[model samples]
Target: WSPYKLLTVFTFIFQTASKDGEVRLVGGQSSHEGRVEIYYGGQWGTVCDDNWDISDAKVVCRSLGYSDAVTVLLKAAYGAGSGPIMMDEVACTGNEASLMFCRSNGWRRNDCHHSEDAGVICKPNEDESGSEVEGTTHVLDRSMDFAESLKNLYETRQFCDFNISVKTNGKESETSIICTHRIILLLNVDANFMVKDGAENFTLTVDEECTPYVDDFIRYLYIKKISVTLKSSKCIHKLASMYGILELQEFCSQLFTQLLPEDLSFQNQLSLYSYALSTQDTMLADSCLQYLAWNCKAFAESEAWYQLTWDQLGNFLFRSDIVVPDEFFLLEALESWILKKGPNSPDLDKALIQMIRFPMMHPEQLFQLQFNFTLYKSHQDLFQMKTLEALEFHTVGFQNLNQYVDLSNIDYMPRIYTSPTWSYLLSGSSIYNQYNPYYRYDYQNFYSQLRSYSSSFHTPKHTSFLFQSDMIQWSFAYYESAQSCRNSGRYCYYDNYPVLLLSFESRPSSNYSIQYQNKALMICKDSYVSDIRDFKNNLVVLPSNDTSSYTFPCSSNFSYQYVVRPLYYSEFQNTQ
Candidate 1:
C-alpha cells in the first residue's frame, strides 16, 4: 500500500510539472484560441499547418497550462501571420514542451502561404477559462481594483466567451459567474469537477453561500446600474467584494466573534452558522456551536430553540455544560419544553431523545418516572448520558447550599453584593460579566496569604463589607440599603439552593487582628434579624499562637490562617 501511494504521488508531480510550461498565441478573439506561436532563439514565429492536428494542438494547449485542446484549425483561422514561419510539419506525441522540441522542419522552412497559419482553440482551465492573461495572476490590489476588474472582464467576455452560469440544488440558488481581472484561479484539476458533464459551456454548481444572484450579479457587474436598490446594492457589494472566495473565511469568522451580542444575535447566528458551515468556514461553525453551548439552558427555554432542527437541538443535549443539576432534572426540562410544542408536535428526534441517562437514574426513581412518563428508544445515547452524568456528579460536582452554609433568613436571602474600594491590589473597579473581569477571588489562595504574624488595620467604622483584605474589593449592601441594588430581584438570591457556603470570597481591609466580623450587626445591632448573631457575629476566627495555618471548628474543609499571639502568653505578659 505504501509503495503504491508513493508511486501515485510521484506520477502526479510529474504530470503537474509536464503541464506547467510557457507558450502563447496571437491574433485571435481570445487568449485561449489563436494562431500558434513558439518562442525560440529569442525570436517568436508561427507553426506551419503542413501536419497541424489535435495531437499537435494537445501539446500546444498543455504547454500553455490548459487542460486540453478542443480543436485545431487551418488556413490562418485567426487571420494570416507575417514575418517568420518558424516551423513546418511539426510532430508531437502530445508530451513535448515546445513545438520547436517536436520533430519540425527547420525555422522559416515552411513551403506554404501565410494563410495556413495553423490556429487552435483550447479548452478552458475551469476557473482559469475567462481570466485575461495578466488578470489570471496579478489583478487589482483592493476595492478600487475590484470594481475596475469587473468592468474589464465584462467588456472582454464577448471576445473570450467567459460568462458562466451557476445553480445550486434548491430554489432561488441560481446565479451567474463572471471572470474579472481579480479572478485569480488556483490551477488544479479538482476545480474542474464543478463543471457539469457534457455541457456545451461551463455550468458550475457550488455551495449555497457562493451561488450568485443571476440577474442582480450580471446587471450590477456586467452592465453598470445607474441606481440600484439599497438591498440590491448591499448584495452586489458583498458578491463583488470577493464573493465566494475562500481567502477571507478566517477574517469573517473573527468578525462574527467580535460582533456577537453587539452587532449579531441568536436570530442571525443560526443563519450565519448554516451559511458558514455550508461554505466550509470551519472556524465560524465551531465558534457558533461553542457560543450556543455556553447559553444552552436559556436557549433551550427560549422560543428560538424550538424553531431549530433536530440536529441542532442534539448538539446542545450532548454538551457537558448544559445547566442542570442532574440527568433527571435535564430530562424534566426537556419534557416540559417538548410539551409546550403542543399535541401535534413533530416526531421527536429518536437519536437525541435516547441520549437521556434513563438507566443511570436511581432504580426507584427510574421506575417512578417510567410509570408516569413515556420512554423513547434511547439505548446508546441515554447510556452515555448516564455514565457521563454519574462521573460528573461524583468528581467535580457542586452541591447546593442546603448541605453546607445555612441561609435561614426568611426576609433576606444571601445578598452577595460588591462595593467600590480604594486599594493597591488592582486598579479600577467594575462589575463582572465573567468575560474578563479584573476582580478575582479564590478562597484557598486568599487563605494562604494570611500568617500568624500578619495583621491589617482594623476599620469597623468602614461599615459592613462583603470581603476584607489589604482592601475591600466587594462588600454586601445592608438590608436597609437593598433598594439601591441595580436589579433587586437578580441579587435577591431567592432561588433556594446552596453550594459550599463556608466558602467566602471577598477583599477589603485595614485590620490588625482580623476576624469574620459582621459590620451590618455592628451598625444595626437592634435590627430584627432572627438568630441575628448566627448570620453575623458567631463566625469569628481565633488564631493559634504558634501554628501558622488553622482549620475552622465547624468543618475540616475550611482552612484559614490568622495573626494572633498565644492566649497563655498574652495573659502572662499582662500580669508582668
Candidate 2:
C-alpha cells in the first residue's frame, strides 16, 4: 500500500470533518505546528513552506471552532527521518490547508518518514466561552450585568417576561411576573427572576416600577414644548439676533474654512456688522467683529475706512459742537467743494474759501452775519469759520452760496438765482413744455410782468407773508393752460411759465367768499369750488362786502400782471 493511503486512514480516524467540511482540532493544542502528513489522492505528502503568517494559523484554528491560534512552528519540529516522506522534507506555513500542498526545497525528496508532519489539538480557554461570573448574588450587585443583558435582549428583539421569586431559608416566599421588552437593572437589594431558557440570578432590587419606553414619542414631546415656548417668548428676538451675529460667524469659520472667497466687498459685510451693533448687545457685536476681522478682508478694510472717516467728520460734528442740521449742510457744502476744488486738493483751506464765497454768501446776506446762528450751536464758531474758509475760493459763481440760503421771497434772489422751489418749478415747466407749445404767449406775458415794476399791483407788506389769493388764481389759470396743451398732444411752449399754483386762499381759517360779477358764486370754508369758469362775468369777490373783485389776467391780451395778496395765519394752516 502507498504511504499516502496509510496516512489518510490515520487522519480520518483522528480528525473527523466538521459541518464546515474541515478537519477540526481535537484536544490539548492551542495552535497548529509541526508538519503533519496529509493524504491526497491515496498518497502521503508533505506541505512545503510557501507564503505563511499567523493569519494562516488563525484561519486553521477557527476552522475547527477553536477561537484563534496562539503559536505557529515552521520546519520539522516533531521528529526526523522517514520513507520517501511522500514528498522529501515536509514544510508547511501556517496559512496552507494541509502539509501535502506546500512548496518544498527538495526536502520532500528525503527519506525521513516519521519526522515531516503537522498536527494541532483543541485547547479551550476561559475567554473562549465568552462569559465570566464577576460576582455572586449574595454580596455582589447585578445591575451592570442586568443592564448588559437588557441591552442584548433589546438588540436581539427579544420579548421578556421576568418572574421574580423571593426565597427565605431556601423556601419560596413571594413571586411576581413582570412582562417587559427590556429591564433596567438598578443597583441595591436582592432579587431573582426567570427568563426564557435560564433563570436570571439578579442581586439588585428595583424599587420603582418600569415605565413604558417610547424614545421617539418622548423626544417629540420635548422638542414640541421647547419650540412652542421659544415661539411665544419675546426674548426670542434678542436671542436670535445674538445667534445670527455671533453663532453664525463661528459656525461659518469651521464649516467654510477653505471655500471663502478673497475679494468680498467691505460695504456688504458692514451691513451685517452694523445690524449687530445696533442691537445694543456688546458681546454679540464684539464676536461678530472678531470673526469678520479674522475671516473677511473687506471687513478689515471697511473698519479702517470707517474709523478714519469718523475721526475726521466726528471731530467737526461733535467736538466743534456743530448742530446736526449744519452737519448735513456741511456735507452738502463739502460735496460742492469737492466738485470744484478737485478731489485731490492738497489743502482744504482754499476749498473752504470757494464754499464761503457764493452759496454761503446768500445765507450770510439773508441772516445778516457770516454764519446762520439758527443752524448751529454757539461752540461751532471756529469750526464754521474754518469750513467757510475751506470752501470760499473752491466753488463757482453763486451756486454753492444759494444752496444754503432760504429763498421764500422773490425780492431776495441769490446771485446764483437758484431757489429750491423755483428749481423744482422750472424743471416741471420744462418737462411740460416739451409736450405742449401753445402757451408760449402766456409765458412771455408772465415773464414781462414779473420783470416789470408796477406800484399799482398788490404786494404783501411783510416779505414773509406769501400771497395766497394771487397764488390760487395763478394755479387755476396754469391748470387750465396745461390741460389744454396736454389734450392737444403738442409742445406746451410755456417753458418758463409756472404750471401749478400754491394756494394761500385754502388756509384753514381764511373766511373768503367767492363771487362772480358782484354776485355770490360759492360759499367758502369746508366747501369745494368745482369750477371757477361757471361764475358769470368771471369776477371773484373776497370775504369783505367791499365789492373788491379780481380778474383773470389771461383774459385780456393774455395779460400776466397778477397781484400778490398778504397771507393770513389761517391761509398757512389750510395749506398745511
Candidate 3:
C-alpha cells in the first residue's frame, strides 16, 4: 500500500479500536501495522470501514501499547478477512481508551462486506530488533536501571576510592564527608580536581549559604536526577556550575523557567531574571523577559516594578512586544520607575527615557508627556528634541513619512498596544507555481480588529495577527496568478500578477466601537523585497459609518508578499 494509505489506516485503527478488546494485526509487513482484528465474545472478526478515520485508528494503536497511529486504511487494503464483520460505523473521538468504548453499530450487525474491512498502520516500535510475540511474557531485570544501581553502590560504599570533605565554615558535621568513586567524580561531576598520585583524600570547600545544595549536587552525579525546589534552584544551579555539571546547570535553568512564572510572584520573576542574566542563561533569561513583557501592565503595578533599577526598566522599555493598554501607560510606568530611582542626573534619566518609542504614542499622550511629566517639565530643553521628533512622525502624512523621517529607527516601529490605537501586524504569503501552464490560486487569511480586548488577556498578542472574536467578520484575500503562460506553449512573457482584497463587516448591535479618531494608518510592506521595517506603501482607512468596511486598490507586482499593519489612532495623528 502507498504511504498515505498506510498512514490513514494507522489513524483509523487507533481511533476506532477498544482497549478492552483483544486486538491484533493480521496481514501487515511488520507487527506494528496490518489488517485490524478484534476478538469479541470468543470469536475473532474484522471491523467494517464505515466512517473509519484517523481518530478511530489512534485508539486501536494506543490500545495495543503502541505510541501512536500513522494512518487509517479502508476498503480492505490488507485483503479481505474471514469471520463476521463484527463492528460497523465505529465512531471514536480519539481520546477513547479502546474501540469497545466508542459509539458503534451493535456487534455482528454490520451492513458491510468482507472487502470493506478497516485497517491501520501504527507507529513502529523504536526498538526494531523484533516485535515481541503475543501470549509471551518476560521478566525484567532490576540491574537494567543503571542510575539506581549506581546509587545503590554509592549508598553501600562498596568501592569508594575517594573521600570528599565538604567545608561549610564552622558548620561542618560528620555527614559532610561523602565517600564516592574517583573516576565518576573526575568524569561526570568535576574534571578539575587534581589527583595527587596515590592520595585518596579530597576536600572541597563551599560557603555555608551553599551547603544545603551540596548534598543534592553530589547525589545527582550518581542518580542523574536533580532535586531542586524554587527557593533552592538558583543555589543548586550555582553549585552545579561550580562542580562543572553542565547538564545539571541546564536542568536548573529549565526548572526556573517553568516554576518562576507559575508558582512565585513577579518579584521572583525579576529576581530570577537577574540571576539568569548573571549566570548567562540566555534561555531562562529570555523566558523571564517574555513573561514580563506579556504582563508589563501588571508587572508595572507590582512593587518589583518600582524597585527595578534604571537598567532593568530600560531593558523592558526597549522590547517591542511589551503589552500595555497604550503608550501612555508605558509613560506612566516610566514616571513611577524614575520617581523610585530618586533624584538622578538629567542626562542619565533622559538617556533611559529615550528608549520609549514616542512615535508610537498618541499626539495627546506626547503633549501630556512633554508638559505634565515632572522629568520633562524640569528638563524641557533635554526632552524638546524627543517631543519634536514624535510630533513630526505623527503629523507627517503616512505617505510622506519615508521622505520626512528615518523610518528604519526603532521609534517608528509600533509596539503591541492593547488599545485600538494599533492592530496586530497582519501577514500572509503567496508563492509562484510553475507546474501548471495556466495557474491562479486564491489565498484567504482571516484577522479581527481590537485584539488586546480578547478574553485571553494574559496571552501575548504580539505575534498573533488573527484577533480572537466572533462578533465581527474580518478577512483579507489575495490571488496569485501565472496567467502569462496561458497554456501558450510555456514560452510566454513572465511577470508578477497579484491582487489584494480586504474586508471588514461588523455584526449588527455589535458592542465594539472604535475609540479616538476613526482614521487608521494602514501601512503595507512587501516582505519579498524588504524587512518588516521597510514599507512598500501606506493607506489611510476610514471605515464608513453604515458598514464599517474599507478596501485597498491592488498594487501590482507586490501584493502577494504583503505584511500589513493597521495602526489605530496612536500610530498616526490627524495632522490636517
Candidate 4:
C-alpha cells in the first residue's frame, strides 16, 4: 500500500476499531505521532519502552504510515500511559509491518513503569496531484515527511509573508519570512503543497507546545537574511560555510585586497585565522599565524594563549615563524602549557615532544627540552633526526618541507598584533610643528603633559559610547588627552609621517570612532594638526594596531583621547 494510505489506515485503527485489535497513537498534537497503545483483549493498553531504539521506533513509525522514526522518547513524552504494559524490550529491523511482527518480551510482561512508555514521532508522507515524490525531511534527528509543499512555496515565490512567533524570556517576538522575487534564486527547497488557498498570509503561532524550536527558528530567519554585513562572527562564519558566498568564502580575496595583518585586533585576528583555515584562505591564515609566532613570548603569557590545546601549543613551538627575540620562547611556553596539564595528565604525553624542532633551538634550548621531554632510548634516533632537520632549517631555511601536523576539533583561537614598521620617517615634521601657527603649547610642553595623564586606561566594550554605561543607542569614540605631544619628543616621528603611539590602559577596541564632544563634529586626519579650531570637518581616525596603545597623531600636542563605538568584529575584520 502507499505510505499515505497506510498512515490513514493506522489513523483509522488508532481512532476507531470496535474489537480493539490494532495499534494507535494518543495524547499527541496529531494522529501519526504520540503515545503508543495497542488494542488487546477488548481494551486499549500502552507499551513499555525498555531498551527501545531506532529499529523499534522505525517499526512503530512505518506501521502508523510514516517513512521512519525520528527518535525514541522515554519518560512518557506524551504523559503517563494507562492500561497494561503491553510490550517490553521490543526489537525490530525496521522492515516489520507491525509491532507484533517484531521480537519482544511479549505482552503484559515488562519491568517498566508507566513513565517508560514508548513513543515515536513519525514522518508524514504527501501525495499531492497523484504524482507524489518520496523523500525524508530530517528534523529533530528523524526521517519524516515534513513541509514538502511549503518548501515548494518558499522556492516558487508564489506566496505571501508568513509569521512565526518566537517566545524568549517569557516574551514572544513575531518574526516574518517575507515572500519576494530576489529570494527566488534562493530558499529553493523542493515541494508541491502550499498553506495558502488564494493570497491569505499564514501566521505560524508558536506557543508552549513548541517552545524548544522558537530560538532555533529566529536564528534561522537571521541566517536567511544573508545580510551583506553581519555582527556576529559565529553567524557570519555559519552562513559563509553553508552558502559559500556569504562571508569567508571570498574573504581571503577581500583580505588580500584591503587588509594588512596589522589591521585586526587580537580577537579579530584569532577569528580570521580560523576563518582562513576553514575557507582555505591560506594567505590570511599564514599572516596571522606569523604574527603569533613573532610575538610568541607575549601571546604565551596572554589569557587567550593559555587556552590553546596541546596540539596548538606544540605546533606553535615547532614553527619557524616563532623567531621573536629568538626561539627559546617556544620551549618555555610548551613547558608552561604542559605543567598546567599536571605531570600525570595524559595530554602531556612525552611522545608529543618529538614535534618540537630541536635543531633550530640554541644549545641551551635543546638542553631545556631534553630536561622536559626526553628519557627513552628507544626514541633516541627519531629525536636525533628531528634535531638535524631543525638545524638544517635554521642554517638554510627548509630544504625540504614536511607535511604539517594535524590538529582537529579546534573551533576557536585568540590573536595579537605585531609591532609597527612605518612606511615614512616623520623627522621633518618636528620643525614644521614648532613653527606652525596653529596654537602655542602651554608650559607643560609636549612630553611632560603626556606623562601626567596615564597613556593607558580601561573602558568596557561598547558599540557606541552614549556617555551612559548601558542601553547605548548611539556608540562612538572620542579622544581624551592624558598626555600632550610636547613630552613625546623624537618618539613622535615615524617614517617622516607625524605618528604617535597613544597608550591608554585600553583593551583592544573593536573599531575606530572619534566624534568631538560638540557631538558629531570630527577632526579629519592631518586637519589642523596643531590647531583646536580645525576640528570641524576633519577628524582623523589614526591607523589602529588594536593593542593597549593604538596608532595615532603625534606631530601636535593636542590633548586627544579617542572614544570608539563597539562594532561587529567582522565588519572591520582587517577590512583590506
* Best of the candidates, lDDT: 3
Distance from true position, residue 245, model 1, in Å?
5.2
- Candidate 2 — which residues are off by over 4 angstroms? 1-236, 245-381, 390-576
Q: Which residues of candidate 1, in runs, are more than 4 Å off?
A: 1-159, 166-200, 204-245, 248-265, 272-282, 321-329, 341-576
Return the lDDT, model 4, position 22.
65
Write down the TM-score of every candidate: 0.32, 0.17, 0.50, 0.31
Q: What is candidate 1's lDDT per residue for 1-576, written digit by digit as tens?
A: 232232233322211111212457888777788999776445576777978888899989887778889999998988877655566778877766555456553444444557677988999777756444555443322433434544554555533333355666574355556542212121212122223352334454544644444444443433233233422332333343334422222323444543333222366557656755565656566666655553444455556666666666666566532323334655766666555655433346445555564422434455455355443332344544544443432233122322332222211111111111211111011111112312224665652111111112222222112222223322222111112121223243211111001112354343422233221111011111101011211122121121111110111112221111001111112211
Per-residue lDDT value at 464 in model 1: 17
Q: Which stretches of candidate 3 lie over 4 Å from their true place?
A: 1-143, 169-175, 189-202, 207-209, 262-265, 420-576
| Tens digits of lDDT, candidate 3, 354-468 | 8877766666677676567887877677568887887776555544555556555667666656554343333332223322333234465533121101010112112112222
Each candidate: RMSD: 29.1, 40.7, 20.2, 28.5
Give me candidate 3's TM-score against the actual structure. Answer: 0.50
CA displacement after TM-score superposition, residue 234 of candidate 1 (Å): 12
The order of the candidates by lDDT, greatest first, is 3, 4, 1, 2
**What is the TM-score ranking, best to worst?**
3, 1, 4, 2
lDDT of 4 by residue, 210-263 (tens): 444433333333233322232233333333444444223333233332232333
